[model samples]
Target: MLKLRKLNAYYGTSHIIHDLDLDVRKGEIFCILGRNGVGKTTLLRSLLGIDTRTRGSIELDGVDISEAPTYKRAQFGIGYVPQGREIVPGLNVLENILLGCNARSDGRRDVPPLVWTLFPFLKEHLTRRGTNLSGGQQQQLAIARALATDPRVLVLDEPTEGIQPNVVADIEKAIVSLNRDHGLTVILVEQKIRFARTAAQRFVILEKGRVAAAGAAAELSNELVRKHMSL
Candidate 1:
């Protein structure tokens, strides 16, 4: 569903991602794994047009989106839940989710039933200020907001980062359900090796802004993990 070829990204004058190539098939969870500073987040940002500059090709569902603006890309069915879960601090939970409706072609603003199904807690607290929620709750709210976009491809950057352990499992299950049951195409940048192994069909390990090793998830052996990911 998504492909990148010879992609390079820069922040200001300093390049971060170098000649990177990747592919994510429809209805599959494609995980990106790497140590810090390997351009994992940069890659996601480039795909969404958030980086300072980018070169080469970015295609989604066979359509080239390399030159599209960020909003246009979102309207093209790319829902991004950025690494920090950048929920608006002032908006209520419901309002925050509704923000994603800006990308909807149908012009509807109601929260999708799927969000309520994935996170029942959010439905009950629609009036609560988004910033008042716990980190994990905030993360769920972030995902809910993205789901409100009615996207064909969900781009998640570290959905489980800095959450409580119990909530991490909940987030993981939600991600799995989104991909396995709902058939949403996913491009995930994840640090949790166990979840990546269990949930992803394929993965790419990045090193110094380029792909070092990539293959079926089952092939992400312990030795490979130690060599590339262990700090």
Candidate 2:
């Protein structure tokens, strides 16, 4: 559902991603794996039009969105849960989620039934300040906020980072359910190799701002992991 060709991304003149080309198929969990400082997050930001300097083609469902503004891209069906789960601290849970509805064409603000289904606790704490929640709860809120956009493709950057172990499983299951049961296309930048192997249908290992190894998840062999991802 998403394709990038010869994509290059930069941050204020410091080049990061270099001629990166990738494809994320519909209804599939596409995992991007790499050690720190390898441009994984830059790639996701570039896709969302958050990076100020980018070149080449970014297409979603056959239409080019390379030059679209960030809000326009979101309106075109790209929902982003950024690396830090950047929820507004001052907003209550409900208000934070409602921010995503700005991307919808109808501009409707009602919380979708799916959000409550995925995060039952959020329904009970709609009035609570977003910054008051636990880390995992905050992450769940972030995902719910993104889902509020009704996106065709979800871009998640390190969704499991710093999450509690027990809550991590819940997040993982929700991601799988979103893809398998709901048919949402997922592009996940993940550090947990075990979860990546189990949840992703295909994987790409990034090295020095470009893809070094990529294939069916089963083919992400130990040797490749050691060579490209090991500390």
Candidate 3:
């Protein structure tokens, strides 16, 4: 449902991403992988129109969105959960989730019961302050907040960055549910190889701001991983 072509981005004259092109098919999880500082985040920013210095075409479905603002992109069904799980520290869990409703067109809003059913811990912590929750809980909150928007496509940047194994398992299960059960399109930008295997149906590896490798996830071999992502 998302497509980008010949994408170029600059950060104050330091050209970071160049000539990037990829597509996230509807009802599939497509991953963009690269080492640190290789412009994965820049690509995500370009898609969201967060980088004013970007040059290229970004489209949701068939509509051009290169010049669209961040809110407009969100309105176009691009829900983003950034790398850091940027939840409000002072807001209670329910309050934090309510902010996601701003992306919706209708005034009447509701969080899907499945959201709480998936993360029952959040139900108990509804009135609890965000700052009081542990890191994993905060990560769950971030995902919940994005899901609260009920977007057609979900863009998640490094969802497992600092999460523990069990929590990561839960998040992965949630993603699978969203994909297979709900048919949400996903654009996952991540560096974790093991986790990458779990979510990605196709792979696009970026290096020095360009696509160096891409294919069916099942086709990614040990040699490819070694050359492109090994530390």
Candidate 4:
């Protein structure tokens, strides 16, 4: 389980996350929702130790990791898939996935068989350049790469963004499969109401870097959520 308590983070001199708190249990999908620029991505970065948290504690299975560096935190089984699907364009699909292995070389990833089973297209396009794949395929590669690390907790920033509806469905299906099959903890950062509504059990809504509301999906009132979520 991953827990954040009163997390205070700053980007340069500007404080972005304000006393944010959240918890993600194992085998569950925890969704963070809000409009753009509400510091959703920043929160994920903070959890991954990309930014210096000014105060509070981030704990993974009761171990404090707020002060741990990014690489060290990664070594503790935290995998991140950033918003842009940052796969190396010049590298082949296999090589791109290999980048997830925390290795210093190419075609040398110890990728799990289940990962390729989840994303069979990756195996088929192993030699294709990362840039040549379609948007959905690239997204799949990014996710598959993250799984290569064999993380206990996977934090994804907007998995459904910039892809076709069919692809989004596929990604959602994959997330569900990951949780059900491996008990992988998933923290999903999303702006799409439909994605949160359908995929998450609990929801956390941020407005201007603060948690404006939080509750189980069934308890949330749709009309009010839509009001705060309007762009």
Candidate 5:
């Protein structure tokens, strides 16, 4: 339920994303795939209105949010789990997740039940400092924080990157469960081809700030991956 048309993004006149167009259908996992420096993160920043100037239209559920500020975008139901899991250092686990409640329109400040259900460990460690967590726990904390926003669409950048293998599987399972069970629409930027293939219903590969290839996940063949994503 997110659409981008003729979208271009820049960092102080250095254009990063060209006239990229994409549509993320409701309740599906849509992956953005590309090698490094191909504008995947830039596109996400553009969508979030974070540190980037963008042109063209970004429509969410048929309402044009192209000009909306970052907080407004979040209030409009887009939850962002940025790369590096930028959890607040001073905030405790519960406090960090509650930070997302600031974006909620409903005026509720408590953590969403879904967060507790998805991450039971968080409940036991609610008083622990967020940044003191392990890498995998920090990623889960980031995702939990986003979920607390009561989002319709969840956007994640490289959710599994740099995590241990076992924890990677947990995060992957959580992503899939978030979509399959909860009906949350997901827009994911990921480098892992296997997870993208398995978890995404559709995907786009970017090159030089534009879409190089896009289709149903089944159409993402070895040849296409080699041509566009292989190092």
Candidate 6:
């Protein structure tokens, strides 16, 4: 239930996302696929009102949020797990997760039950420092923290990038479960084509900051990957 129209994003006059138009339906996983430097991360930042400056319309459930601040967007039901995970270095696992509660409209500090259910490991290590965890564990912690916001739309940028192969599968499975079983809308910026094809209901391939190809997951063919995403 998110829509973007004519979205142009910039980082200090270096234009990134260019007049992009996209739609993410309710309770579905929508993948954004592109090679490095194609503005995938910039687009996510634009949606979240992060560093990049943006122009045009961003609508969440029919209400315009183009001018809303990052926290306001989060309060409006967009949860972000950034590209690097960006786990707060000094915070314990529980404390890091509780940080997301600041975005909650209700202003509750309690972590949602869903976060524990999806990542039971987090519960056991609630006292552990977030930065002390493994890469995959930190990624899980990031996702768990985002879930603590109780967002209607989960926006993840490269959730499995550089993750251990064993843990990558777990991350993929969690994303699928979140969309299919938990009824959450996911906007995923993913590098892994195989996982994207299997988990996403629809996808768009970006080139030079704009949609080059977009269709159902089944249409993410070998030819398309070779054309838009091959190194």
lDDT of 4 by residue, 1-231 (tens): 888899988899888899888888777889988888888999999888885556799999999988888877777888899999998969998888877888212334587798788999889889999989888888999998888877888999998889988888889899988987778989999877776877788988888999998888775578757777876
Candidate 5 runs further than 4 Å off:
none
Clashing pairs for model 5 are none
Taking the tens digit of each residue's C-alpha lDDT, what string does model 5 give over 125-206? 9999999998999999999999989999999999998898889999999999999998999999999989999999999999
120-227 per-residue lDDT for model 2 (tens digits): 999999999999999999999999999999999999999999999999999999999999999999999999999999999999999989999999999989999999
Q: Whose lDDT is higher: candidate 1's or candidate 4's?
A: 1
Compared with the true structure, what per-residue lDDT tens digits does model 3 show for residues 31-68?
Answer: 88988889989888778877548888888889998887
lDDT of 3 at 61: 87
In candidate 6, what residue range of length 10 has the lowest lDDT sum? 111-120
- lDDT (CA) per prediction: 0.94, 0.94, 0.84, 0.85, 0.95, 0.95
For residue 127, model 1's alpha carbon misses the true position, in angstroms, by: 0.5
Evaluated at residue 177, the lDDT of candidate 4 is 89
What would the per-residue lDDT of candidate 6 be over residues 150-176, giving only the tens digit for each residue?
999999999998899999988998989
Give Cα distance to truth, residue 100, candidate 6, Å. 0.4
| TM-score of candidate 2 against the unseen true structure | 0.98
TM-score, every prediction: 0.99, 0.98, 0.96, 0.94, 0.99, 0.99
Query: Candidate 4: worst 10 consecutive residues by lDDT?
Result: 103-112
Query: Which one wins by TM-score: 1 or 4?
Result: 1
